[model samples]
Target: MCESPVRHAHSLLFVPATRPERFVKALASGADCIIVDLEDAVAEGSKDSAREQLAQHLPQLTPGQLTRTVVRINAVGTRWHEADLALLRNWTMHGATVMLPKCEDAATLRGVAQKLGDGARIVALIESLAGLDAADALAREPHVVRLAFGHLDFQLDVGIHATADEPELAFARSALVAASRRARLPAPVDGVTTDTGSAERLAVDARRARAFGFGGKLCIHPNQVAGVNEAFGHTEAERAWARRVLEEAARHGGEAFSLDGRMIDLPVIRAAEAILGG
Candidate 1:
């Protein structure tokens, strides 16, 4: 199995695969990862054309490229699944990860895993109530490496009242975080902010998601990428505090220690390690 890279403090920017002109520029953007989206972003008639275009560009990426590449395919139960799988099978791209949308069970994942063999990785997008309920089982599937929340579809599926604060979707977000932790995966990715240029609003949303234990946030535009990265990356103060707490604990023979007069223990150490990408 290929081990996933330690992805602390990174932005995954989504680009519509059908827009061939956007592909090179997106990959060249400073974002840590580029997700060529074949779902939500692409229209019905354009899906196959997008797949073919992606196949042509897949080989153009050189070794040791700075940005990691991923493909967001349509939901498993949708009509697009077979073509997406076929494209993935014949491609020779390096470090390609598939983002499986609307994943609701382990069986669906097992099928994809069998197709990808053991070398490829799958990222699950938990979008519906059924998928949220099945998250633990889904995460345990052999091919799944990460889980991401699909807030828009989730809201529609659950009939949640829409608000800027997203109060109605809080439970689903919490469930995703808890399930991801239980499955020992990296922190689940938060959903996108539709506004392309509103950095202040994006920062607020990103910070809120980070507070809820999300390690990353999705982006609809390149402008949103930097803000998401800034929100999720460890602050200097955080790094210093983590180091102090660890050093104090070590000095005390691995016993609990006080940092700024607050008790710090194993959980604190683990969280510090996560932030520091240790």
Candidate 2:
């Protein structure tokens, strides 16, 4: 049920939170961000143990590592969410990104913001009908740096038995992208492709996501990272545009400036950084 990352991540690879053993391996998997998941990846009986194990190892990552790593907590209604929030509230994580699953509105984000208090960056997952309906509100939340299309769960929620061909979810994906752009957030993160073994399929999905204005794709397997990254990689024109954006931003002292009528703020700056590998 987890969403995506707030930071500019081209490929966010998920590693089960219960399997602390795989944490290091995930870090070395070449993903732009490695998300330690405490949601679907953890069994109901093992939620607490997963949280505890995650809390123990999460802070061990160095500052640089923390930037590229995130934690996907349980959804709001789950029994594990409160404990998950408590763990995050009390921990000494230096700049950990937290992925909020089943985000249906801004109120939930406001509550989370009060608890985290600007200590974390949030990625809101629009999984349910309520979430998709409230996508604009979720995007408007101050702590939410990005939105993600939880395509699988949404399809389940809507009773659609569609495959990863993704035509059925086009409207949903487009809505998310529009919401994100209107809110001046980074381009939304697309849902993961389940066919992790098929690099060709993964690349196709990644390209489709990019075409829909998504900035990145989630990865269930480390093997999918490179393909996703390649699909979203900057073209020559993108690199040139990024250079221009940064230069114009710098000229205006990096404040809320503009270049070619597009507002240049933190999200745009982050996107530019990603393009130039800044």
The number of the candidate with the highest lDDT is 2
lDDT for position 197 in model 2: 75
**Candidate 1 minimal-lDDT segment of 10 residues:** 1-10
Q: Write the per-residue lDDT of candidate 2 for residues 243-262, one digit (tens) a residue.
A: 99888888888689867888
Clashes of 1: 0
lDDT of each: 0.80, 0.83
Candidate 1 lDDT, 97-210, residue by residue in tens: 788898998897889867865566788999899999999998777678788989998888988867887777788888888988898988888899988878888998899898
The residue pairs in collision within model 2 are none
Ten residues in sequence with the least summed lDDT for candidate 2: 1-10
Residue 128 in model 1: lDDT: 90
lDDT at position 245, candidate 2: 88
lDDT of 1 at 52: 89
Name the top TM-score candidate: 1
Cα RMSDs, all models: 2.2, 6.1
What does candidate 2 score in Cα RMSD to the true structure? 6.1
